[model samples]
Target: MLQILNEEGEVVNEKAMPDLSDDELKELMRRMVYTRIWDQRALSLNRQGRLGFYAPVAGQEASMLASEFAMEDEDWLLPSYRDIPQLVFHGLPLTKAFLYSRGHFMGGQIPEGVNALMPQIIIAAQCTQCAGIALGLKKRGKKNVAFTYFGDGATSQGDFYEGLNFAGAYQAPAVFISQNNRFAISVPVEKQTASKTLAQKSVAAGIRGIQVDGMDPLAVYAATKEARENAVNGEGPTLIETLTYRYGPHTTAGDDPTRYRTEELDNEWEKKDPLIRFRKFLENKGLWSKEEEEKTVEQAKDDIKAALKEADNTPKQKVTDLIKIMSETLPYNLQEQLEEYTEKESK
Candidate 1:
């Protein structure tokens, strides 16, 4: 129910909004624009056969950007494959993100000082990992909290319930963020569950549940900030359902959304695009202008181009490197198989 800006981008409730400085507001807008540009470039790269695959965070930029900004530096982030924006917002380098998209093993390495896990491809697996990380931090007497990102469809998985239950029972410091994009690939929310709202599912887990207008950056930031504070205070886990949407197909080289969604729906959602909406709000505050917007977009595009070029220029991963980095001591059968493959390749 908390809203700072209305659909038209007018400040409807400024009194309840955070007193974000002009510079911070502009930075948020810039990041959202950058994320949009990066997503488009990645999708195009996938289409041109340059990258393996991509998940476009076209409409959910505000949700990711704001939630990430709400976290402390030492907080842990357990993200899914579709959370590239969240990672990027947390200062993850664009070059490394490009490396990840290009399937480089080096991309899996977490940068120093970043408490982020490699993006999990398996659906809902990061939830359990987040819970475990929170428990470990608690036992060590660390004040850091874990923030886990997943989709609404993942709520149906057993891991989701188990993770929340365990976090609550042990009073682990964690926050579960469900990006309820209204669809799990081709399956709609109605087909996934009869629960009136995804937030309601958290009730039985003995955690605080809240829903937010994900398109509004302020709302996402406020909710996450509150949840994060609770976790650090040992109030246990909180579940946040971010009501957002993916404006494009689930992923590049994946299913077609046109077959399931009409152009009308897409257009309607486009009207509510988070980047555009937030920009309008900034403009209304006399903090943003068309010229500044153009500059930001151009800079973001240049950065993406540079990242793609860097990704392309990186040395191709040697097949042997995979085997070398495997288990320290391979099993007898696997070692034999690896030796045979190496011998054949040497020919």
Candidate 2:
């Protein structure tokens, strides 16, 4: 696996280190801290019954944020349900993210200039969509790429292969990232597939494939940066498998990871926590301090509070509102239902 920083936060592969400026490195750290804070707060909100349908993102910050850090604002991002951090960082409003988890229809609408789709709830579906988007960019002579993310479990789905095959055949400018957190909810990686490495699956699609230590933000950033470059250069797509872990349950909807995960295994992965190691690295370089980190934490909390308030202030969606957006001229059945709901709501 590709790795720059080891578990102790020491650079093990100096040659593979990304050539990022100190300020850029600091920005990446700040974003990771903010994302982690947001993830924690979202989970709390879910527990408090303020937010619905949340997937905890405590341990996958490097895999999510670092890869996104490598992308340009113009590139298209096709994210899976677990990738809200990437979407928000890509310019989707945080309030929209909250609304989405709350199942509000307005959350689905992408603001102009934000090149992203709402998080795909269906497994592996975004793979095909990303392929199509990449092909469109190529046909239009755009220099941008389409970047999509999915879990290791998604590789077993038919759409994954179909998407890669189509993108490879068309030489579409795309990058597909698989965050192999070792379990598809409760199923272990060993049970998911007998394949030695998830990255090797790309060979069948005739694309470049590589594995990276997902806990190492620098490594994740480097791999994604190169993948994006290859894509924009018309070299076709790449499949990147990030070896990571999720410290929390699969979702806030009553998943008990303890039934499948052992204390030993969890402890092992905890030693490699992305935030701890990355913080150590920055501190060693005289780039980060406890004071700065505390400030960032406070800032994130305040921002999340504001975003949640905005989400709370949004007008509650009505059935008629959904019907109106479904079509400019509704079908007869929908029209009748809309009128019924509208009239009932009026009362």
Model 2 alpha-carbon drift over 4 Å, by segment: none
lDDT string, candidate 1, 162-267, tens digits? 9999999999999999999888798889898999998888899999999888888988888898898999999999999998889988988667998877888788
RMSD of each: 1.6, 0.7
On lDDT, the candidate that comes out on top is 2
| Clashing residue pairs in candidate 2 (N, C-alpha, C atoms within 3 angstroms) | none
What local lDDT does model 2 show for residue 274? Answer: 99
Give the lDDT of residue 23 in candidate 2.
Answer: 99
lDDT of 2 by residue, 1-347 (tens): 99999988899999998989999999999999998999889988998999999888899999999999999999999999899999999999999999999999988898999999999989999999999999999999999999999999999999999999999999999999999999978899889899999999999999999999999999999999999999999999999999999999998889999999999999999999999999999999999999999999999999999999999999999988899999888999999998899999999
Worst 10 residues of 2 by lDDT: 183-192
lDDT of each: 0.86, 0.95
Q: Which residue pairs in candidate 1 have backbone atoms (N, alpha carbon, C) closer than 3 angstroms, thus clashing?
A: none
Residue-pair clashes per candidate, as listed?
0, 0
Best by TM-score: 2
